[model samples]
Target: MASLRRVFATSILASVLSQVLTATAQPAFGVCYGMLGDNLPTPAAAIQLYKNHNIGTMQLYDPNPEALQALGNSGISVILGTKNEDLPNLASSVEAAKSWIDAHVLPYQGVNIKYIAVGDEVIPGESAQCVLPAMQNLQSAISGSSFSSVAMTTAVSGTVLGASYPPSSGAFTGDAKRALSGILQFLSNTHAPLLINVYPYFAYAADPSNIRLDYALFTAPGPVVRDGDLSYWNLLDAMVDAYYAAMERENFPNVGVVISESGWPSAGNGNFTTPQLALTYNRNFMKKIVAGTGTPKRPDSHLDGNIFAMFNEDLKSAGEEQNFGLFYPDGTPVYPIFS
Candidate 1:
């Protein structure tokens, strides 16, 4: 009897410890740490800002050595990127992919490298042809290394959706279908999520007359649109579900979707581009995700996303491109994110 009781006690203790670890290790909402600005803070200071704001995840456009070094032992999850220009080299040779990983990823000791995004919005052309091969090679390299826990994915734009209205009608068009199929197959095999950049701001600005500002801002008074049985109260949810539907149509309905980037520009040419609007949109977005309410199409799943930028990148093209940052280059908050 004492032996059975001991076993039971051990089992209960193990269960409790598992639950505690799961809760503590849950991924926090992330921000994109873009380094396009001339006056952005050093990576160490940037990590401090992230710590201040309770941001536990960060996405970088490239694996800069300094940034990777700063992230070490920081307890922050990182999603690193390989620039489009390097895809050809990585894809052409598995040795190159392994070498790149060794140089960029392996050295970052204790930094929780979650995902390696191969390229940003690469469509099926000469560059796009290299994406899948590079991803495959990278995945193999990571699997063989100490960082096998890291996953591989590519970020694509919402323009890949052929028909987005009504959400259920979503499907990939043209070269997107071919490119995405290979990606989806890879994701399915590895159980990695699809990273997509969903910009309701761009969608709204493109057709302001048709897209309601309140809906785009996630302050919809009521259901803005009903597609079949699913009712969408906000544009972000709809935009995400459109990708879900597209994936479903591709017969990979179970693959997860991660919004790699989404944010409203604080200043630009658009009538809706203002600090107040940006603040409203970002706050509302943060609240919705924190609430853990998934889209109507995937109500049981928590959607993981990263806000577009950490600072307004002055080096970007004129207008909205330079105004997505939540902070100034000097690490000053452009607006309060948490209140």
Candidate 2:
């Protein structure tokens, strides 16, 4: 254990030292700014934190007024989301979608809204029926205007996959297959990427006996899984490739993918959640992204993604959900992810 800690310390030190030479470089990835904690820093302060770290992109779970205000003219690329509960209303009436855009988006002219996610992880559930229509209405609302450049899409969890093993065999399940067909078509038509939340930590925790820790943490020294000519050294790439394969099987072969959320918990279950593991996973993940190392399936593609959250949300459900933050609510980093 001491040797392992020393290895982690050495690897982190090397990464931090390397970052000093590239302090001004724009980060290739983004972090989700979730506001579910009472002790969280103000939106302005949070925006400053992102600037201080040279972060160039962010994902907001919803259009919080203060956050959007803070983002105005800040020059940070944003992926703004709509509340799942609002989907029914937005889907039912194009006027409701137009009103939503008029209220939450148009006023913030300085904000760089890259993508507007209609709903989050509501697929394969009660609100699943509302997703495609809401996206259509929102797209119509934003058409032929400055906001037209802002892509329309929705975020879905990895559970939408029926099979993921071998990466190439990935396919959507029965329910998700039926529901996502039209949505996928819409995404392809609009040239928007499908946003997915991929968590190797959860995959490993659920079946540590089968999933290796090194594989999940991006520390595996050699290829652990070989799929035809492709080799997967880490779980992230494999998971991403699986999603791509699934999309291809769904007949949306050209639709791109953007990782909506991914992170490890700093504290929760005994061994599976720890500061060391969280730091390792996030730092390595960022490095992989910064290097523009696309997954084997999309070797030349420039992948876009966001870390799960900026700060720990104390108000979240107890355990892993609350612990997926890169920083504490007090504005201090839970681990030195930014160096």
Instruction: For each candidate in the order shown, give its overall lDDT on alpha carbons.
Output: 0.83, 0.88
Q: Tell how far residue 247 is off in model 2, in angstroms.
A: 1.2
Which structure among the candidates has the greatest lDDT?
2
Give the winner by TM-score.
Answer: 2
Provide TM-scores for the models.
0.91, 0.95
Clashing pairs in 2: none
What is candidate 1's local distance difference test score?
0.83
Q: Which 10-residue window of candidate 2 scores lowest in summed lDDT? A: 12-21
- For residue 28, model 1's alpha carbon misses the true position, in angstroms, by 2.3
Tens-digit per-residue lDDT, 20-113, candidate 2: 4286467778899999998999999999998887777899989999999999988799999999999999999889999999999999999999
In candidate 1, what are the lDDT values of residues 1-339, reduced to their tens digit? 345334433544335433433454443568999998788899889888887777768998998888888888888888899998999998988889999988898887778899999998887566888899999999877775789989999998976888999888888997899888988999999999999898899989999999999999987889999998889999999989989999999999889988889899988866779866787787667656555779999999898788989899999999999999988888876665542
> Could you tell me the TM-score of candidate 1?
0.91
